[model samples]
Target: MNASPKPPALTTSRAAAVWSLIGLVLLTLNLRAAITGISPVLGELRDAFGLSGVGVSVLTTLPVLSLGLFASLAPVLARRLGTEVAIAGALVLITAGILLRVVPYAPALYAGTVLAGAGIAMGNVLTPAVIKRAFPRRVGSLTGVAMMLMAVSGAVAAGLAVPLDHAGGWRLALAVWAVPSLVAALVWGPLAIRGRRAAAEPTSRPDARGGTGRADGSLLRSPLAWCVTAFMGLASLMFYVLMSWLPEIMRDAGHAPATAGMMVSIMMFVGIPLGYLVPVLAARLRDQRVVVAGIGAVMAVGLGGLLVAPSAGWVWAVTLGIGIGSAFPLAYTLLSLRSPGPSVAARLSGMAQTGGYLLAGFGPLAAGVLHSATGGWDVSLGLLLALLVPEIAFGLLAARPTYIRLGPAPLVEAKEIVVPEPARAR
Candidate 1:
């Protein structure tokens, strides 16, 4: 009797997709854990390390700086190593960095921070690309899930930092995060090997399924690219600035350290739902200008509240959380939506993150410095408000339904978009 054979390829693919989704979510969960834990215990670390104002600024700036500096290398890595392998490599960096930071050496702290942040840089740039490639039809929903998970991770890290520190000093609190990164890296190991095999196979196409084959596009030359970069940069600048200094602002306003840290957690908690919904909403829209304008307005109100009345800090935190939560996800969604293919998506993600995070690095550093000088948060908060004008303007420009002009190709659009005269040449 002949037995019917199960379709091995189909079964294997289904299994792989399930694993991909799991690995992707796990990776997103760890992205913010390493960084967000710091703000809760910033004062303790400062006192322990004898950090001066400049040292504090540098410490605060390290994450954003590493993200910016390492972002450009993402697409390059994708080009050299397979995307899966590159991401695997990123997780390795994150795990090692997390472990490194908790060592008794002083230099290990900054060095580890930079290393972890760099790994985050890679994750930030490629995560959207992976979604665009693996779940093309489900981009909106999957992105929502990923963003939601990322917010959840950040909130958890912030909320638990104090508790963890109380249980076992600051070192143990930071060291605990290494567990997630290590687990994620292990999960990625087989995926990376499988990816490499798929890339080498003659019948396999990397571009079709998260491989990093080159796509035809001169992304850097496009002005729309700059608009996307500017909007993302400014949005990130606002978010990181608040994340880095919001705790200090609250602490100085007479809130307890735990309470102040919880504000950061609250901000992230509010982000959880917004992170899920914003991408879903933005993805359904052909023109995102209204969404962009609305986010800016919300952020403005929050900042205004913070500046005028630090007494009601929780109110501002929730408000800021909604705006900040929506803004970054929107920026991330544009990276995938604006591109026609995975290759272009990865490239655009790299470009946006490199320029954007570099611009954002200045935010935390400047915020730290400004607070140090003025000895108050009003000036720093006000500057963030002023920056919103340009943020919204660029957001409007970027939200146009036009796809980035690729190489010498004429501008493409998801819908009919009239190319402005100034953008025609580029």
Candidate 2:
């Protein structure tokens, strides 16, 4: 019998490409649904699970902590399993975690959150790196589209979770989210096999910034790198903390629960358009300074309005929505823009995300703890303002046109690459 030719390694079929895109969208949608969805129902979940304030905070903290912990390891996992397998596996974990809430026990509920967070962590870190590998030519536009979908999905889940809970019980509400997670896993599974085939095909590997390698400490030591990291982290810190606490803040200002939740949804909804818009816009601009300044000013205006006039809160909410939506996409764009190429992009993305997320992990908890200690919302909001200054300063630096230089500069023309919001390693 003739020996069978060795199966081609990592060759993606045309079918795999189409399915991978679908899998990407679905996976993006799954990332925030559980946590953002839970925020709207936190009061209910706290009561149902018999959680104290710390316990309630833990519910939110566990996911972020897990995200920070696991995100650091994503590159290694992708190397071992290939991106498709890692992502597909993440979807399975996410599905299991989302369904865990249905068990009617605190341990199960928290355990589910932990597992789900780990899934999200892997997806969050790996997706951008995968995108860097998959779509080197159009990172910005693609990142924009994926992030837009991420926002839309997150908004839908957060907006509807309460209604769903009211209509069918929290167990049903939490469990129902499992449907999408499982579907994503199924969609990605075949594509993953195909993806492995594509990987096996010999293609000239791109340069270091684009190639798969662990980023050096030299890149880590650069000021530009720190700027990217701080910009991403502070932006996320604001984004996540606002998502977690904004509804409650608005409610304290006298808006009804529905209205308060809707405000948060609106903020996220606006983010979808900006997710697409910001990167596209930023890519065309020579310097991102103007974009950064504009977004920072807008955010300041929105926050100022909210602080000054609690009665006209919805207007400020809209303003905040626009500001945040715009700024967030720009932050993601910088990951690719500042990197010399794909490898650096991935490494930078990883560094920025890992560090940024560690800082961001503190946001919700800090806001909640401060609120509890001060017995008011003002102090908490004030702390956010304190943070805004550094966010803007670093954003200005990151927005400048530059890339991290490795050892000796090759005598090659520099090429610009656009990164997307969801594509940010974090």
Candidate 3:
């Protein structure tokens, strides 16, 4: 009897690489659809569910809170399960959650939201690490591509939600989004299996960033890391607030329901091209402080415009879109740029996203509470304006050309094995 040959080592072929990129794009597309899709049909859902203002706010807040709470688990899962496998699991969770949300029960809806959000949070933290490992040389371009797709998908979901709800009611509208997650999972599963096989094979190459153990602990003490966290958190707070309430703002200003939804879409659509462009540019720059300040200025101007004259909603939408689109990718880009290597990138991403989303989760709830208390949008808008100060300040600090030093420097001896001679010289 002859011995059987071992299977060939796993390698990424050109076709396979293309498929992986496509899978990533598809995955990015699903990240926000489940969250943003609900906003357009929120009014209908409120009526159908008999929800009060706070209940409506919670509908948006719970998923975002889940994103933050679950993000820290990604690196742990990836270490235990392999990155690709973890991502596949996330997709499954997303699909299941999306399906569960349409079950016509409040508990089911919230549970589904939490499930889907947890899944998305895993993908959010790991995507940068995957890109860092797979496309080190083209991080900017690939990050741009992923961010652009994210914006495009979010825009489409927001724009189409009301119409889809009209066509088949809110349940169908929300449930139909699960199809994309299912498709992405089908596309990604084989890739994950291949990755698992490759990882199982032994290699002599040093782990990226030297070692992954306890190195991330240093980030807790690094001022730069805190700055990055603040910037990410505040930006997210602003974006999610707009996403949750922009349609309502438009409608309150006298637009029809469909038009109001489209206005939100317009804001998101304007960000798509800028999302692709901003990261590429930010990556090439020496220091991103100027760009950060510029984006902040744009957001401030747009928010002021909306507060004063929302009837010209398109103008404000375009401005706000460009500001957010540029700011978001730039923030994500900094996660990779400021880190020394992929492991550090993963840690930074996890920290930024965990803290960021946790803070962001409060934005919608606070806005709802303020509006309820004041019976107007003025106080809510004012709060957003106040947040911009910290965002811009921290963004500038985080944008500086510096890396988070993970551990203390090695000790150096001025004189070795010459104590007597050194004392004589002294």
Candidate 4:
């Protein structure tokens, strides 16, 4: 019997690659616009709709919880439709969900979020694989750049939504975001067409083995895989907590609502450039442990400032922003860096995010509950501080220059694996 033929290479001209990067940035920009945009408007919506704190928290929680389930279904959807088509369809669902808020009914509001979140979930899980497949040599750079776009869009939407809502209604503010989504869809529409054309060609069939395996039992057995999963999970938990509670945290410190919202936006703003910068730097480093520790230190300092010196809050927010911003993209970059191939990247991304965001979903809820219990943000921030310890430890493990070594190959002789001591210290 003949050995199986090697897969065809992903072919895109340098110009096409550049264009795809641009498209990726735009697509990423839309992913969180609807979600982060809503965070600023939550108070307005809650009052208008007669929602309780728990009710609003439920609204916030549902999308992230749904993301894991939606992500599980994404591979199937990608198989049924081409990947680009699935991504495009997700954008349409997001647009429809945003539009649904025009009615402002409780059911409609919640329903729209679910639909919109589904779109975000697919984009979140798939974009890394797409980036890796399309820009193999520049995974770190592209992941950083794309995540930067996400941070920028999120900050813009969070900061601007209130002003937009005041000028136009919340309905208009919510729906106006549909323009960017539509624009991204339009930009990506051509790429999808190009991909479909390419995919339909006989030459393209060689690349179509669904390269990675399913996120099945064997994946759970891998220790390195668990490290990646934990790193992704803890990082996401930190992110969602800030996104969900930062503005309120600022408000409690006595800032005006608008100012607090802007402060929250500012924290995310510092992350935008770092999102692009950190990954490029990290990729060149021998080990990412130093970077991980440095970022964690920055985060600790920023959080400590918030707890100790409420007067210098703005400065601390900027510091926190840099720390969190860099950390977020780094976490995303790890998904690709740790995977053996595009197939594995896809599978691991789905698994990591499924477990990761489920862990993340609890962060803000726990923060809110802790605040209610203790009557302050101190306990909440303290708890987050404790969580960061493990994140730093696992991030160091993940940051090391090695992919997840699978179980012994069938025909190859067994050899002792070189387990790094630093990773074990974590």
The candidate scoring highest on lDDT is: 1
Q: In order, what lDDT does every prediction score? A: 0.84, 0.78, 0.81, 0.77
Task: Assess candidate 4 and give its lDDT.
Answer: 0.77
Candidate 4 Cα errors over 4 Å, as ranges:
1-19, 47-53, 193-217, 247-262, 405-426
Model 1 alpha-carbon miss at residue 59, Å: 2.5
- Candidate 1 residue-wise lDDT, 85-170, digit = tens: 99999999998898898777768888999999999999989998888778776677778888898888887897799999999999
Which residues of candidate 2, in runs, are more than 4 Å off? 1-16, 198-203, 207-219, 251-258, 372-375, 405-426
Q: Count the backbone clashes (under 3 Å) in each candidate.
A: 2, 15, 0, 1
| Model 3 TM-score, 2 decimals | 0.84
Ranking by lDDT: 1, 3, 2, 4
TM-score, every prediction: 0.87, 0.84, 0.84, 0.83
Candidates 1 and 4 compared by lDDT, better number? 1
Report per-prediction Cα RMSD to one decimal: 5.8, 5.6, 9.2, 6.9
Tens digits of lDDT, candidate 3, 277-360 = 887777666578999999999999989988999899888888888888788888998887676666667778888999999998
What lDDT score goes with residue 234 in model 4? Answer: 90
Ranking by TM-score: 1, 2, 3, 4
**RMSD, candidate 1, Å:** 5.8
Backbone clashes, candidate 3: 0
Per-residue lDDT of model 2, residues 370-405, tens digit only? 899988788888878788899999999888877776
